[model samples]
Target chain A: MPIARGYAATDASKPLTPFTFERRNPNPDDVVIDIKFAGICHSDIHTVRNEWKNAVYPIVPGHEIAGIVSAVGSDVTKFKVGDRVGVGCFVDSCIGCAERDLDREQYMPGLAGTYNDFEADRKTRTQGGYSDSIVVREGYVMSIPDNLPLDASAPLLCAGITLYSPLRHWNAGPGKKVAIVGMGGLGHMGVKLGAAMGADITVLSQSLSKKEDGLKLGAKEYYATNDPETFTKLAGTFDLIICTVSAEIDWNAYLGLLKVDGSFVVVGAPENPIPVHAFSIIPGRKSISGSMIGSIKETQEMLDFCGEHNIVSEIEKINIQQVNEAYERVLKSDVRYRFVIDIASLAA
Target chain B: MPIARGYAATDASKPLTPFTFERRNPNPDDVVIDIKFAGICHSDIHTVRNEWKNAVYPIVPGHEIAGIVSAVGSDVTKFKVGDRVGVGCFVDSCIGCAERDLDREQYMPGLAGTYNDFEADRKTRTQGGYSDSIVVREGYVMSIPDNLPLDASAPLLCAGITLYSPLRHWNAGPGKKVAIVGMGGLGHMGVKLGAAMGADITVLSQSLSKKEDGLKLGAKEYYATNDPETFTKLAGTFDLIICTVSAEIDWNAYLGLLKVDGSFVVVGAPENPIPVHAFSIIPGRKSISGSMIGSIKETQEMLDFCGEHNIVSEIEKINIQQVNEAYERVLKSDVRYRFVIDIASLAA
Candidate 1:
């Protein structure tokens, strides 16, 4: 067994504190990674604070993981020592399960989350990556392409794949007008990815504060949702609108912005239900859908696509000790984009 | 001008009464039809009683029409005297407009409702097929196939296309498992049409009250949505769900029954917005969409398909005088399927 040191919330009310735990001995298909950078996701805060109310204490919450493969089990064929890789929201799912058989492991009922979830054995709680090292099955680990900095690529594991899956599923490409709602980590990645995918991109933010940054990130237009005219002027304009705002928005108004046969996809989830009228979708044959993070295969493809397009999350690097302060900024939406924790600081 | 006798609602508070109106003289591109039968849609009841709140007084509400072409204008090359024909929700849209040019006239802002709405001239209040006759542009009139009876085909004009458009738009066909919610007029059409399209049909009614009828209408299975186990057993089972009930439902529970990438399509408009959690659509990438009645082109296609398959509405025939009684029954969902008025009663 390898000893790993990380930070964890002992209870919902407390900040994450340094803790040492034993990682499982590598299975035949496992890859042991020396975590270089771990991206802090909004979900991490939600889980640690038990805002979603399902969090387990003593939880090490980080799923946006990027690292170098330090060792591989005897039967690990996909990765070699020193290979750059990453892991997303989950580390394992029962391979022969129905959802996995259909290549939809992310939705599998038996999926083991990277943190606060029991592994396939149902006895051991699988911990996550806010750590110095993580042991993952070869299949769950994704290769980070060269030239993309490890810190910037970390968020791609979560935010990148979250946006990429829907854009591809809905066929957001050339001649497609896509609007990304909110200018946070997920929405910013949506702009870069949607623009890279040849879509005419627009950023729909709460205000014009992020207008300059959004446009520079490949948005052709930026509109403030607080301004009523934004809704009026852009009515029935977009072929696809990816709502990255976790707050409950006026869903019907956004549905109105979709053209005939367009889709409004939600990636960010609010606690309560969003109310929508049949009139909004019926008149134009519009649809409202939601997507979670991509499957391992699709996640790899997203990373490769990023490699080709030079896409990486705009990240604020933070020392491991700065995580508590970073969480505060994330809650206020004050971060430039994403915050990636330097895992080496844990070693020191 | 031609004198047209019909039943009309004098106000929202009273029963429909015998009233007289004038039919427009034929325009150069018009087809004047001597009305034979008119289907009483739920919308007619909604309009007459001000349930939808947009009704203009003395409204003669009927749109699902079946009749004979009594006259044709000089440029009406499509129809001649005594030709069997039908007209649906609208009589005309702004011709040569972008949407009308594409044959999607129903979505056009200038679409003229068959009753209570001003004609394209913006001055004349358009009457409907409940009258003895109607004069409509030739392009908007559909030719009823020789094999289909005019009375039974009346509901096919409104109810048929309403289901067919969404069923087709969502690609309901062979290998697709389609669930038709609500077994009323619109839903029965969905059952017939979805079955004819080679889909594995299921009817999800409020209870097994219509189980025999549903199976007879070609549904392979019938489930009572009132049964909790039905939701559990059929979880993620359907590829398409067409909700024809105008009443608000537990939208999230229904959304849970869809398979990955499936759609819950609403053809019926409810008075209020439905609350849906982001969890319903996100994990499975499921969608909630809505479809109105088809385009003129698709309506023709639906009719052609119906004709080819010998499909028509299961109707209860009523004289125009009984329409008020029919309205009461419609509100109670007491009709076998649909009611088609004998327009000849108006002539009497």
Candidate 2:
């Protein structure tokens, strides 16, 4: 067993602090990763605070992971000691299920979360990417493209794939119009990815504050949703509207923005139930759907796509010691887009 | 102008009474139909009583119409005198739009409802098929198959096409497991259409009171939604669930019955907004969608399909004088399936 140093949430009300734990001894199919960077996602904050009411005590919370392979088992053939790799929201799934066999393991019944969950044995607890190092099944690890830097690429493991899967599933490409509902971490990635896919992209943010960044990042238009005219001007405009904000808003008004037979997809998990009128979708033959993170295979494809398009999250790098402050800023919507933690600070 | 005799709703609180109106003179592209049967739909009750708040006084509310062509304009090519015919929810749409050009006129703007709405000129009040005769453009009329009787085939114009459109749009066929919620007029049609399309069909009704009827109407299984065990047993069981009940129920519970990537479509209109938890659809990548009645082309396809399969609504025929009583029974769900008004009673 190898000693792993990381920040752990020991209590729901307290800040994360340094803790040391033992990593599992490598299995024949496992690869050991020396974590280089970990992005701070909103879900990490929720798990640490027990807001979802399912967190395990002393949970190590980080899923957007980018790192270098420190070691590999004898049977592992996909990576060498120096290969760049990443781990996303899940670490393992039921091996023989149809979803797993089709490379769509994210939706499998027996999926094991990277953290706050038990492994296949149901006894061994699983930790996540907040650590200095991690041991993952070779099948769950994705190879990072060489052109993308580790720090900026971390969020792609989660946010990038969240937007990519829906875009591809709904056939967003040339001649299709896509609208991203927020300008935060997940939504910014949607703009870049949708634009790279050749679709005309728009950002529907709360105000005109992020209009410049949105345009620079690939959105062709930016509108202030707070303005009443925005709704009227964009009525029946988009082929797809990807809602990335968890905050409650008028979902029916947004549904009105979609073209006939268009879809409204939700990536963010809102706390309250969404109140949608049956007439909202019925008149246009529209749909309101949901998407989770992508599978292990799709994540790889997303990373490859990002590499080809030179797309990465606009991030602010922070040390492990500043994580609590970063969380507060995240709550206030103060981060530029994302916050990535440099793992080298774990030693300090 | 030709004098048309029909029952009309003069006030919101009063019972319908006999009324005489004038029909537009035939144009070069017109067909004059002598209505034989008009099916009683819940929408008719809503409109006449002003439940939807958009009723036009003296409105003759019937869209599920079956008739015979008494005369055809010089330019009519599809039908001759004495040819069987039918008319559905709409009479005209904006010409040259993409939706109309694609034969999907139901979703096009400027759609002229068959009743309680104005004609293309926006001045002529378009009365529906409860009358003895109706004058319509040839493009808006459909030719009924010779084998199917006019009375039983009446509801196919509305109830039949409502379910058929979603079944085809969602690819419900062999290997697909479908659930039709509510076993009323709309849902019963769904069971027949889905089974006829080769999909495994189930009925999820409030109680098992209609279980035998559901099973006899092409459903492979029936379950009482009031039973807690039904939800647990059928979790993730359906590829598609078409909700036809306008009453409020737990939508999240039904969303749980869908398999990964499955859809729950709505053709019924609930007065209040449905409250759905985001988690219900997020985990399985499921969707909640809506479908209206079929387009002119698809409605014709549905009728032709029903004809080939020997399918027709199980209807209780009533004379025109009993329509007011039929409306009361319909509100109580007392009819076996549907109520078809015999137009000959108007002359008697």
Candidate 3:
């Protein structure tokens, strides 16, 4: 067994503290990653608070992982010692699930989560990258671009692909109009990607708090959805609308803003049900849909797309000890975009 | 002006009565159709009772018009005297307006309705095909194939296209699993067209009342949605579902029946909002959207497709005098499928 040290919340209402755990010894297909940075995502907070009832206790909640390969097993050919890498939401999956194509291995059917989850055997609890190091299968590990700093690149594992997968799937490109709802960590990536994809991008935020930032990120327009004019002015306008917020929204009203055969894709994970109206989808042939995180192949493609377009998330760096404080700030929407933990601080 | 005769409901509470009205003379681009068969859609009943308040009364509520081209204006090249013709939901749109494509004119903004509507001048109330004759633009009128009977083909104008557009748009074809959520008039058409398009069709009806009928009409399976086994047995199975009934349904429950990236297309007009859970769309990338009646171009294709497949609505033919009784029977879903009034009965 390999010992690892990380911060975790033992209870739903508690703050993070030091926790000791053991990782399995390197299998021939595994690579031990010295996690350089871990992003403090909203899901981390959700898992720590046990908002999802299935959350395991002593939960080491971190999924957005950015790191370097310190060691690789004999059979791991995808990465080598000193190679930069990142591990996203899941660390293992059924590579041959029928739903997946031959080129890409299907994930999440029996795949182990980075934290608070079990492997296929369901006995050993899988810890995550809030720790100083993580061991992942090479097939699940992806190469990080050289230009994107490790700290700033952590959120890309989760937020970046969450936005990119839907936009690309829906064909966001020249002559298309795209709207990014909410200006939080996920929304910001959608704005950057939508703009980089050559779409006429607009921001539909709660208010105009990030109007200037959105335009600076290449958005042509930004509107406060709280304002009545937003709905009237942009009615039947957008070809694609990507929602990144997790709170409950008026889905029917939001769907009303779509054009004929338009789609409103949700990356948001609200706790409640999404209420809809038949007329909302009927008149213009609009649709409301949801997307989860990307597959390994698409995640690599997203990173490549970002690297080619010079699109990187605006990240705020923090020490591992400040993670609980960062979570508090995130709840208040205080971070510039994302908070990435410097794992070196854990060692210190 | 030309005097036209039809049945009209003067008030919401009153039964339809024989009424005489006047229509403008055929314009340069108009084709005067001597209405032969007018299909009684559930919507017509809803409109006469003011269930759909948007209806403009002293309403002559008929849209599924199949007739002979009694006369054509000087510029009319598409239809001539003695040609079989049909007029669907909308008669005149902003003809040359920017909202319309010259090829696909129905998508045009400020689209005009077929009947129970105002003309471009916004004052003259337009009467529909329940009358002895109707004058529509050459662009809006479609040619009915000579092989199909007029009464059987009447519902294809609205009910057929209503299902066909969504099925085609969503790519319902070989290897696709489709479900039609009602076994009434529109749902039956969905089953037929979906089968014609080469998809495995399933009918999700309230009970097994129409099971054998559905199978005869090209459905591979018929299940009572009222049974709990139906949900459990077919969870996450469909690629496209055309909801053709006008009642409010469990949007979330229906959404669960879809596979990843699957869409639940709404053609039925519901009186209330359907509550949805974001979770349904989020986890599997599912969608819920609505569709209106098809464009004139697509309607022609639907007519041609039905002709090729030898498919037509199962209809009960009645004289104009029985239109009131047909309305009552439609409310009970007592008719086999559709009730098409023989327009020639109006002359007697």
Candidate 4:
């Protein structure tokens, strides 16, 4: 057994506190990683508080992980000791199912989450990268480019792939008009990645407060969604709009912003069902879709794409002691973008 | 002026009565059609009863029209004076707009409905195919294949194209698993067309009462939506699901039946907005979209396809005098599939 030190929530009502747990021994195809930086995703907050209603007790919630390979099992060929690496939302999935494709395993059945889930054996608990050390299958481990720092690059594991997958899937390259709704952690990355892909990017934020930041982050235009004229002026404009907000907004109005045959994809989830009128998508033959995080292969490709574009998330670094306070600020949308935890602080 | 006689709704509350209206004088680009058969669509009932709230009174409600060419303008090169023809949902659109494609004019703005709408002049009211005669632009007329009879082929102008457009758009063909979500007029056509396209078809109706009819029409399987087990048994089973019923049902439940990267397309309109949970699509990267009727170009393709396959709507022919009673039966889903009115009875 490998002892791992981390912070975890023992119950839904309590804040995460220092805890120590034993990690499973490395399997033949596993790679042991010395977790360097962990990004505090909104999903982490949701899990710690059991907001999604599926959280397991003593859950160490982190999925956006970036680190260095400390050890590798005998059969692990893709990763070696001292290599920079990363892990995302899942650690394992059904490997041999006929429906499982190498490039789309994230959407398949039997996906084991990095935390709050059981491993393939269905007996061993799988903990995430909030810990000081994590062991993941070599196949799920991604390589982080040397130029992108681990702290800022941590959010790319989850936030980057969430936006990048839909953008690439919908063909958001040259001559494409893409809109990224919301100006938060996931959205700011969409602006950067979409603009890097040669797409004309626009930010539809609740207010113009982040217009300067949005424009600086490679957006060609920024509009305040609070104004009614925003809807009227931009009706039937975008080729694709990736909504990154979890708030209950008028989905029909956004559907109106797409041109004929355009798509509106949702990456963030609201608490309740959204009301959508058929006429919203009927006249233009538009679509409303949802995308989760990308597959392991695509996530690595995204990392390589970021390397070529010199892209990394705009992150605020904090020590492990300040994570509980960071959750409150995140709820208020007070962070500039993402908050990354320095794992070395855990050892101290 | 050309005199035309048809049954028209004088007001929202009263039954349709015999009314005489003037057809526009032939333009240099017009083709005059002598109406022979007209298919009664649900939209006609909705418009005549003012259910959609946009009906112009004295509306002549028919768009699924089959007829013969009584006259052709000097510039008409596609049709002769005695050619078999059909007129669908719209007779004119913004023909020269930048967004208008020759293959997708039905989704564009400035579309002139075949009935209850104005022509390009914006002053002359466009009455539809429920009349003794109709004057239409040569560009909007489609040639009916010689093998199909005028009455049985009438619904292809509307119902056939409505199902055909989305099936082709979503790539429902060989090796594809498709489910038609209703077994009414539009869905029965979907079953035949999807099966013709070499895709395996299934029917998900409210009850298994029509299971025998579904199988006879080429469905591989039939499931009753009213049975809860159907949802569980067919979860993640379809590659494409085309919903043709306008009644509000559990859209989320239907969405769960799609495979990864699958699409759920809507051709029917419900009066109110439907509530959809984000989880319904996010997990599978699924989509919910809408498609109206096809353009004149694709409508011609559908007619040619139907001709080759020997396909026609399963219709119950009724005299024009019985249309008011037919509307009541349609509201109750009592008709076998469609009711084609004998336009010769209009001249009696």
Scored by DockQ, the top model is: 2
Interface RMSD of the predictions, in order shown? Answer: 0.8, 0.6, 1.7, 0.7
True contacts kept of 1: 0.86
**Candidate 3 local Cα displacement, residue B163, angstroms:** 0.7
Whichever of 3 and 4 has more DockQ, that candidate is 4
DockQ agreement of candidate 3 with the native complex: 0.73
TM agreement with the true structure for every prediction: 0.98, 0.99, 0.97, 0.99
- Put down candidate 1 lDDT per residue, B1-348, tens digits, no spaces: 899989899899999999898887788999989999999999998888998789888898899999999889998898999999999998778888777767677887788898989987989998888888898998889989999999999999999999998898889999999999999999999999999999999999999998999999899999998889999999989999999998878899999999988899998999999787999988888899988897888899999999999999999999998999999999999998999999887656
The 10-residue segment of model 1 chain B with minimum total lDDT is: B100-109
Stretches off by above 4 angstroms in model 2 are none
A1-348 per-residue lDDT for model 3 (tens digits): 888999988999999999988888888999999999998889899888988887778988889999999999999988999988999988877767765563233223565777888865578788888998888888889999988778888899999999998999899999999999999899999999989999999999999988999999989999998898889888888999998887777777788788787999988788887667777888877888888888888999999888888777899988999988899999999988999899999877
The lDDT per prediction is: 0.92, 0.94, 0.87, 0.93
In candidate 4, the second chain superimposes onto the true chain B with a TM-score of 0.99
How do all the candidates rank in terms of DockQ, highest first?
2, 4, 1, 3
Q: Write the per-residue lDDT of candidate 2 for residues A1-348, one digit (tens) a residue.
A: 999999999999999999899989999999999999999999999998999999889999999999999999999999999999999999888988888877777888899899998877777889988889999999999999999999999999998999999999999999999999999999999999999999999999999999999999999999999999999999999999999999999999999999999999999999999898998999999999999999998999999999899999999999999999999999999998999999999888
Query: Model 4: per-residue lDDT, tens digit, A48-107?
Result: 898889987889989999999999999999988999999999999998776465478889
- Residue pairs in candidate 4 whose N, alpha carbon or C atoms collide under 3 angstroms: none
TM-score of chain A of 2: 0.99
Residue-level lDDT tens digits of model 3 in B1-348: 988999998989888999999988889889998999999988888888887787657998888999998888999988889999889998877766544654445555667687778766678788888999988889889989888998999999988888998899899999999999999889999999999999999999999988999999999999998898999899989999889887767778888899777898888878888766777888778888888788888899999998899888999999999989888899899998999999888878
Which whole-number lDDT from 0 to 100 does residue A19 have in model 3?
91
